[model samples]
Target: MSQNTLFDKVWDLHKVADLPGGSSQLFIGLHLIHEVTSPQAFGALKDKNLNVKFPSRTIATVDHIVPTDNQSRPFKDTLAEQMIDTLEKNCKKHKIKFFNIGSGSQGIVHVVAPELGLTQPGMTIACGDSHTSTHGAFGSIAFGIGTSQVRDVLASQTLAMNKLKVRQIWCKNRLSEGVFAKDLVLHIINKLGVKAGVGYAYEFSGPAIDLLSMEERMTICNMSIEGGARCGYVNPDQITFKYIQERQFAPKNENWARAVEWWQSLASEKDAKYDDVVLIDASQVEPTVTWGITPGQSIGVSQKIPELKELSIDDQFIAGEAYEYMGLSPGQAIKNTPIDVCFIGSCTNGRISDLRVAAEIIQNHKVSPNVKAFVVPGSEKVAKAAIEEGLDKIFKEAGFQWREPGCSMCLAMNPDKLTGNQVSASSSNRNFKGRQGSPSGRTLLMSPAMVAAAAIEGKVSDVREFLKK
Candidate 1:
């Protein structure tokens, strides 16, 4: 058990009661819903004859099924159209706020909420998507829930769960030039191993984390679930408060000061005790890429894939499967592996800053003729910001398609998908088999800048080379 840590503070603050089964009844301050998961929970509510207990505390957005292209009403995919329609009706019936497509606030639920300031420090946030931990960047205790849990929150605004042990990952030093937060998180996942976080909540701290921007911190927390952590968070600081101060839903005037004061008090005490601690040197992390199925099966761009003997007994089986599925051999260099498609979008890395980084890299080079590349913003706000800065123009001029906002190729629920057996350089998280829609599609996860460099070279080239040039 951890003492005086941010996780403990937030959990204790929201704990409604200690249940008979040793689980705590935790009240969720924020509930974010999307088209894919809400339909079932809303249906469950209908079956039980219950209305949303706190409609105002819940916010709805359509993303998972909404196509980034041809978003015209009565979507070509009847199922997607039906799902969005059901969500609209449900929100209307419940009087919950819905950020529909073209609403200017519409986008991925994770991206939309934070940009709107709906995510604040010390709050317990839940979403039906795994990456809901993305909101934890604000020092909030946030995590994804199953459909049943979604129903629970809608009905009672609370969840029943055992507390997670806290692991303090103290990152020393700052990232070197050309290495971004994506690379750092990948490095963390690779070093810690994916399952190392199985029963813990990660507390990301130290100088390296402190130097990162809010969006970068979000990228770090967003993938905590992939590491098997229940949630991940950074202590809120000036960076967090500044990012939230003027947003649409953030506190204003006198209330703003009170909020910041309270938020500061929620940070982990200087003498906090954690169940575990791991130290890392962020400067050692290079531009990284996933070479195999799991995010943990990754290597630096300049490094070679692991040999079977190099892996532990438990990881060897999956490593073997990954090798065969990825069409990669042991000790093969990940660099210069030809890429067929380059995708830059998703809740993980579709912010305005991500687009700017990719655009800056792509501006001087055109996409290779052998590669298909595109950029999808995380939210309408991100899209609008990029357009204002002409990032879309830069992408288009570099032989990349600039698509509308949605989840895009992240999960490939939409039209943007990889064809059979195509190797993709993706900025989005996850490189699981068939994750990008095609049963045989191969995804290599990397930073947006790395994806841009790959798009230009038609291979997994070192982004540092581009940065140096």
Candidate 2:
């Protein structure tokens, strides 16, 4: 067990009681709900004839099922429409705040919360969505819960869970231009293996993490689940306070100063103890992309696909699977692997900063004649910010469609889905089979800017080649 680390401090501070099953009943300070996962939990409450015990602590938003392109009354997809309606009705019934479609606050739950100041430093946030760890970037403890656990939070505002060991992932050195936090995380995942964090919480610290903006930190922590970590977080600092200071839901004036002090206290002490530690050099990290099904199967932009026989026996089998599914030959460079679609949105990297970075790559460079590319902001606020900065026009002029805000092609619950066996260069998280709403659709995960670079070349091109030095 770790001592004096942020994870230890936050867990102990919010622990309600020790449960009988070798787990602690942890208090959740913020509960974020989306359309897809909340319906059944709401139904469970209805079955019990119960109401949300702490409505103020929970916030509702429609994301997973909402259409990014055509969000009109009654979504074309029957199931999606039903989910929206269920969330709306449930939020109203429980007197919980709901950010519905067309509501400026509505977007992906993870994206909406931080931008709106709802996710604050030193808070413990939970959501039913796997990427709820996204909120951990604010130096908070965030967890992803199952539907039943969702019901638990709604009823009692607490979750029972065994405490996790802490892993200190220290990254020093500075990243090169065009090497964003997405690439940094992918680099870490590839080195550490996806399951390395199965029983641990990751504390992302050191110079590299310290340099990232709050949005970048969110992008890194957002996919901690993909790395098999229960949660991932950065210690609060000036950047954290600056991002939260003027947000809609954050503390103000004296409360603001008090909050910052408390947030500072949550950081691991200089001599903090940890169960494990891993060190990474950011300068050595490259612009990375997922070559196979898992986030751990990533490689550098300049690297070639590994031959099955060259890998460990277990990974050799995975390589074989990827070779068959991705239709790529071993030893072939991932560069120039053709793509048919380019999707740029998800809880992981769909914020305005991501858009701005991708837009720079998309500027003056047109999408390939055969490639279909589009940009979807993670939240209405992000969308508004992009538009204000004229990124929408830049994308449109570069032969990309600028869509409305929602989860978009990240999960493809909406109309923005990949067709048939067509492959994609996506900035979103998850490249699992059928994850993009097409049974045969293939996805290659990369940074938003890398997706932009590929969109222009119609292939897995190196973004560093296109970026200004």
Candidate 3:
């Protein structure tokens, strides 16, 4: 059992009681909902005739099924229209705050909550979306639950789960030029294997992590679930406190100082014990991209795919499945894989920083023929900021469509979807089968800048090479 690590500390602090079946009854400080998942959860509550517990702690938004192209009410997709209507109805009945389209605050729920200061240090955040862990970048413990668990939180504001073991991932050295948090996480996931994090909550720390901005940290933590971890978080620091100091829900001047004091104290102690510790050299990580179905089936830009025999027996089986699905032979270099589309957005890497990096790369460059590329901001605020900086013009000039804020093409629940077997270079977190909206639609997961490079080349090309030229 780990002692005094951030996971253990947060768990112990928020644990309301120990429950039967070896699970703890943990209290949630924040509950975020979206149109897609919350509708069913709210319906379940109505079936049970139960009122939401602690409605003030919960916030709602529309993202997953929202169309980035046309967000007008009475949406073209009747299913999406119904979902948003349900959320509005539920929030009204429960007296909860909702950030709807035209509200200026509407966007991805995970992105909106933190930017608005609704997610704070030491809070236990939950949502019905995998990237809910994005909130953990603020030093909060955030969990992504299924629809059933969503109902649980909506009704009781409590969760039943076995405690997770804490794994300290210590990253040493500085990232090389052009590399970002997305690359570092892909490196970790590929090295650790997808299942290695199944029973743990990762504590992302060390010099490399410390150097990343709050948005960058969110990108790292957002994909924690992709590695199969139940949750992940960083310890609160001056950076964490600074990011939340002036936002709407965060404490005011004197209250912020007091909140900062409390938040700082939540950092894991120097001698804290952990279930395991893994050290990674940040200097060695290159621009990474996912070549196969799973997030773990990734390689550095300069590397080749692993031969199935070189992996563990189980991993070899997993690799075999991936190879068949991805239509890539073993030992082939991941570079120069043909791509038909490029996507930029999601809870993982859809912030203003991501857009800035991609637009910087595509500024004076033209996209290749037949490549359908676009950028979707994580929130209305991110889109507004990009327009303010002229990032939108750069992208448009490079032949990338600048769309409204939403989880566009990440899960393909909306109109922004891939056709046929066309492979996409995506900045979103997941690369699962049918993830980009087509069962046969392939996805290559990379950073936003890398996506831009792929878009310009119409293939899975090396981003660093473009920079050098």
Each candidate's lDDT (Cα)?
Answer: 0.95, 0.89, 0.89
TM-score of each: 0.99, 0.98, 0.98
Error of 3 at 454 (Å): 0.9
* True-structure RMSD for candidate 1: 0.6
TM-score winner: 1
TM-score of 3: 0.98
Query: Candidate 1 on 1-469: residue-level lDDT in tens?
Result: 7999999999998999999988999999999999988889999999999999999999999999888878999999999889999999999999999999989999999999999999999999999999999999999999999999999999999999999999999999999989999999999999999999998999999999999999999999999988999799999999999999999999999999999999999999999999999999998999999999999989999999999999989999999999999999998999999999999999999999999999999996999999999999999999999999999999999999998899988999998999999999999989999999999999999999999999999999998898888
lDDT of 2 by residue, 98-186 (tens): 88877888888999999989998778899998899999999999979899999989999998898989999999998988798999998
State the displacement of the C-alpha of residue 301, model 3, in Å, after optimal TM-score superposition.
0.8
The ten-residue window of minimal lDDT in model 2 covers 309-318
| Runs in model 2 lying further than 4 Å from the true structure | none
For lDDT, the strongest prediction is: 1
Backbone clashes in model 1, listed as residue pairs: none
